[model samples]
Target: MTINLTMALVLAVLYAVGFYLLMQRSLMRILLGIVILGHGSNLLLQTAGGPPARAPMLTSARPEEMADPLPQAMALTAIVITFALTTFLLALAYRSWTLLGHDEVRDDVEDRRIQRLERRLAESEEDAAEELEKEATQ
Candidate 1:
């Protein structure tokens, strides 16, 4: 089937913006990102079905002329999934706001501690290797 350039460009933009927002620290941006991405996915599914024509009824149209219903069904399913995930994200944002007074995600203290420990270990390993090399040279 033929592809629509305009639809393709729109999908690309939606996905690009979605991913950019998803990478942000703000919960609201992430929520918006999910929404945009969901719309992009739905659009992609519809586009894959080719140009809309006759219904998928054999009585109404021949097999070649009838539109495929699979893509529409899949798009509907995607919509439901997206809605559920967005609602969960919304709840999480709300809870976060209630607890922290802000919806921005912060780095965990424990994660930083582990990272510092790993860095120290790596430095010690490098020092040990340097000492070994010095001894071999001497």
Candidate 2:
């Protein structure tokens, strides 16, 4: 109904989608989620100023009808910061994909550790077998 309420609902939906995407394994999806979250936050900031009662910034604007400029400034700053952060994160994701052959970071730390331990155990067993063979020969 009201502009503020409408914006709040839109922001809530966007945030929900962003959170869902953030939980995904794909780097691209996560980055997109971050972007969506940023936009939602910016919209929320703009909405906080209460629907722009009058023209934003002008000398002839009445004191009682003046819209808050602080939110606009904040939105602009947030946009720039989000843009830079998005670029950096996307580049990191690309590099990670290239180096690791996948976008998702390995989630199974225990499995990787167990595999390493197995490799070490196998190597030790081979060494023991070789030593036994040498002793028999002697």
Candidate 3:
């Protein structure tokens, strides 16, 4: 199966940027990231289908000559799902903005508590490691 180099590169870029944006605290960037990720997925689905050919329609073209319809259908489904997800995310963002004046994601108290616990655990482990090193040196 011949791979489309252009589509592959685009997919790679989309996935990279999408993930980077997804990691940000801004809701807008996160939404953009999801959309970009969706585009990457669609491109990947296309690449999974073999070489380019005619559309799989009721034409005079032979079955072998016609392009596989499955990939197209899958891509369409992905598009619809992505659209719905984007709309939902947008609505949430808008509501947050309207109520809070900004769409910044704030961590809850539990997150802070978990971070403190992790920090203490790390410190304890570090002290134990140092003690072990000192005993070995002696």
Best by lDDT: 1
TM-score between model 2 and native: 0.69
| Best by the TM-score measure | 1
lDDT, residue 21, candidate 2: 89
* Candidate 1 residue-wise lDDT, 15-131, digit = tens: 999999999999999999999999999999999999888988879889999999999999999999999999999999999999999999999999999999999999999999999
Query: By the lDDT metric, which is better: model 1 or model 2?
Result: 1
User: What tens digits encode model 3's per-residue C-alpha lDDT throughout 42-111?
Assistant: 8888888777898777776888899887888899999999999999999989999999999999889999
Query: Candidates 1 and 3: which is better by TM-score?
Result: 1
TM-score head-to-head 2 vs 3, winner: 3
TM-score of 3: 0.76
Cα lDDT tens digits, model 2, 1-138, are 246667778999999999998889888888998899899989888888676578756787877788888889999998998899899889979998889987885579899899999999999999999999999999
The per-model lDDT (C-alpha) reads: 0.96, 0.86, 0.91
Ranking by TM-score: 1, 3, 2
TM-score to native of every candidate shown? 0.91, 0.69, 0.76
Q: Which residue pairs overlap in candidate 3's backbone?
A: none
